[model samples]
Target: MTTAGTPTFDDRAVVLDGTLVVADLHVGRGTGGSLELPVGSNTELVERFTSLVDRHDPERVVVAGDLLHSFQTVPRPVDDTVAGFERACREAGARLVVVPGNHDTMLDAVWDGPTEAAARIGDTVVCHGHEEPPEQGDRYVIGHDHPTIEIEGQRRPCYLVGADQYRGSEVLMVPSFNALNAGVVVNEMRAGDFQSPLVTDTDELEPIVWDEQGRETLSFPPLGEFRRML
Candidate 1:
C-alpha cells in the first residue's frame, strides 16, 4: 500500500515492502545539456540516495535507468558520482543494478555486441522502458515513460501501475523517479502505446483516449471542488 499525501520536498524516497527502487538518479549535478536539467545537484542526489539506503536498509537497490544524464561521454563529475554510488552500495551492503535508458544510449552507436540492459532477479525483470517489453516470466517491471498525475490541476511525477500482455506475461510500468523528465500522462495516452490495459478504480484495463499531444486525459473531477459539486 502507498502512503497518502504528496511526499515531502526533502523526502526523495519510495519504499515498497523492504525493497527500494530509486528512479532517475543523475549522479553528476552540474552536467546539464539539452536532454538534462541541473535542477538538483549531484551531491544532493547522492546524499538523498545514501540517506534512503541507510534508513530503509533494503536488501537490493534498483536504479531504474538514467543513472547518468549522458552515457555518450562520461564526464569527470559523472564518473565521480558512479564511484560514490558504488561506495555507498558497498558500505550499505546492498546490491546495485543499472539499466540503460534513452539518454544513456549513444547516438549512432551500432548494436554489434551485447549491451548492459535488463536485469532479472527473483520473479521480477527490470529494464529502462524505451525498447519493447521483455519476455521474462509473468511479472515485469520497467521505467521509460516517467508517468505523472494531473489531479485537480496539480501535476506530479508518479508511478503508473497496470498490467500488459507480452508473450503471455504481465507488465507493470513504473513512473520515472527522475525530477527533470516530463512523464507520459496516464489518462490521456493512446491505447496502442501501452501493451497492457489501462488500470482504473475498478482494477481492470480499459481503453484510454489521447489528446493531440498524446497525453492521457483523466476524467476525475477536481479534487477540492468535488464536495462543492455534490
Candidate 2:
C-alpha cells in the first residue's frame, strides 16, 4: 500500500496500492506542428514519469498500448527517446511490459496478439482501450480515448474515473502520458461507442472536459456535480 504523503507524478500510470501500471509511453518531444500540443512536452513527460517510478518504488510497470506514436517509420528522436525510457525503467528496478496500439501496429510483429494486449494485475485488467474491452473482466483500465477536461475553455488531458453501471465493474480511463497528442473530449463522445453498455449515469466516472477557447462550455464536473445539477 502507498504510504500517506507519498509523492505522485503527473504521468498516466495507474497506481493501485503500491503497484503501478503505465500505458502509452510515447517518449518524444514537440508536436506534429509548431503549436505546443495539449499533451505537453514528451521528453519532460517521460522524465517526470521516470522520476515518479523511482519515487513510488512500484512492483511493476505496464505499457497498455501505443508505446510509440507510429511504427511505420520511427523518427530518430523518438527512437532515442524510447531507449532512454527503457534505460530509466531498468534503473528504477521495475519490470516493464509493453502492449501494442493501432499507431504502433508494428509492435504486433514483436509482441503476440490482442490476447496478450492486456496485462492482468490482481483484479484489474490494463489495456490500451482501442478495441472492445475484454468481456470477462470485472475491473479494467484503458487510455485510447486520451480523455481530456475542458476548464475555462482550456482543454487539458485528464483521467476519467467511474464505475460500470451495468456490470458493476470499475473502470479507469487513463490520460495520455504523451505530451504531443491532443486527447478526445469525453462529453463530445458516446460511452457506448467504444466499450460496453455497462457505462451509464454514475458518479464514479467523471468527464473532465476542456475549454481551449476559455468558453468553459464543455466542462463537466465529477459525476456528483452533474447529478446535483439535474
Candidate 3:
C-alpha cells in the first residue's frame, strides 16, 4: 500500500514477508481497453511500480499474473509496456518475477524475467487463480477477479480474504492494478458467481476496503453472513 509515492492503494498491491506482490497489470489493452480514450496506462503502470520499488525497497517483486492483455497476438504496444516494466524494475533495484496468467500465452515474447508456475515466499503461495493453485501451502495470494465494491455511486478496488473451503489455507485476492478495470463489486455478488476456484469454492469471502489514500477503511463481514443482511 503506497499513498503519496504511488497511486492510492497501489491498486491493491500487498507486501508481506519482504516480497512485494501485485497482480493483473494488463499492460497493453489500450491500457484500459474498455475505457473511451485510454492513454499512458503504460507509463502509469510503470510509475506505480517505480514508486512501490522506491518505497518498499523489496529485493523481489512478484507479478501475480497477466502482465500482458492480448491473447491472440502480441500487440506492438504490449512489447513496449513489457520493456518499460523491465526498465522500471531495473531502475528501482528489485528483481521482477512473473507468474504466467491465462492471457499471457506469449508472455515470454516480451518479458524475460524469472518466470515460474508459482512463487512461494514462506507459506504464501502466489498464483494467478485461473486454475488450481499449488497443493502445498498454508496461504494463497492471487489476482484475476479484480474485485471491486461500490458505495455512494463510486467504485473502489478491494481485497478478498477467506479460508480455503477444501485446502484450509487463507486466500487473499488482490484487485486489478489497472485503474480502469473496475471489477466485480463484491458486496453485490455471490461467491459462486466469481470465476476463481478459491473464490467460488468458498462462501467465506470478506471484503477489505481501502480508501484513495491507500489506507484500510472498512472490513466487511464474510459474504455468507453479509449476503443475508443485504
Candidate 4:
C-alpha cells in the first residue's frame, strides 16, 4: 500500500494513496490559433489514462482542474474525449471527480458527474488552484500552473512540491495532463509569476521529473537553489 500524505508521480499524474490525480487536460485545445495546434493525439490520452488506471487500480480518479480548453463553447471532439475519460473510469470501477478550473467554464455542458471546488482525501485537498480554495487541509494538490523545467535545452514536464506553502499547509502542484500543452518553464519564474494563490514561495518548491526510460523519479533541489545551478 502507498504511504499516506505522499504522492507517487508518473508522467503527468500523481497517485495519492488510492486516488489517481491529474490536471489541466484542456480538451479541444488545438482548434484555435496557428501556434496552438495540437501537439499530441487524443487517442494517446485515453491509452495513457487506461494504462495508469490498470497499473494502479485506484479507487477514485480526480481531475484537479481544467478539463476543457475553450472558454466559450464545447466542441464535438471535446465532448467525445470527456466521454472517453468517463468510460475508462467506469470500466475500472473507479469513481471520477472533476474539480473545475478557470478554463472549465463550460464543464457542465459536457460533464454531469460529480464536481467539487476542493475535493478532500485524507489530509490533502485537491483543487484547480486558479482561485483560493474554499476549504483548508494539511496538504493541497493543485494544477493551475502546469510547471515544467528546462535542462540542457530540453524541457520536461515536472511536479512542484513545497512544505508549509499556504496557511501552513504543504502544496503539491502537477503538470498539465494534456500532452499538447508545452507547459510553463519555471527555471526563471518566481512566486509572483504564477496564477495560483497557493504558490507563495517558488524557492521552497522542489521540482520532480519522472524518468520514463529509467523508471525512476528524480527529485531536484528546491527552485531557489536549483536556479543558481542552472
**Candidate number with greatest TM-score:** 4
Model 1: lDDT to the true structure: 0.51
Q: Each candidate: what lDDT? A: 0.51, 0.60, 0.75, 0.88
Segments in model 3 whose C-alpha atoms lie over 4 Å from true places = 1-10, 31-37, 200-203, 214-217
TM-score of 2: 0.73
For residues 129-193, what per-residue lDDT tens digits would candidate 3 score against the true structure? 98898645777889999998766677778888887643777778889987867688877677567
- Candidate 3 Cα lDDT to native: 0.75
Ten-residue stretch with the least lDDT total in model 1 = 1-10
Please give each candidate's TM-score: 0.65, 0.73, 0.86, 0.94
lDDT of 3 at 109: 82
User: Which rank order by TM-score, best down to worst?
Assistant: 4, 3, 2, 1
Candidate 1 local Cα displacement, residue 134, angstroms: 4.6
- Could you tell me which residue pairs clash in candidate 4? none
Count: clashes, candidate 3: 0
Per-residue lDDT of model 2, residues 103-161, tens digit only: 67555443332335677765666677776655446677777767665555767777676
Model 4: CA > 4 A from native: 1-3, 31-40
* Residue ranges of candidate 2 with Cα displaced over 4 Å: 1-10, 27-42, 108-115, 192-204, 207-230
Local error of candidate 4 at residue 22 (angstroms):
0.3
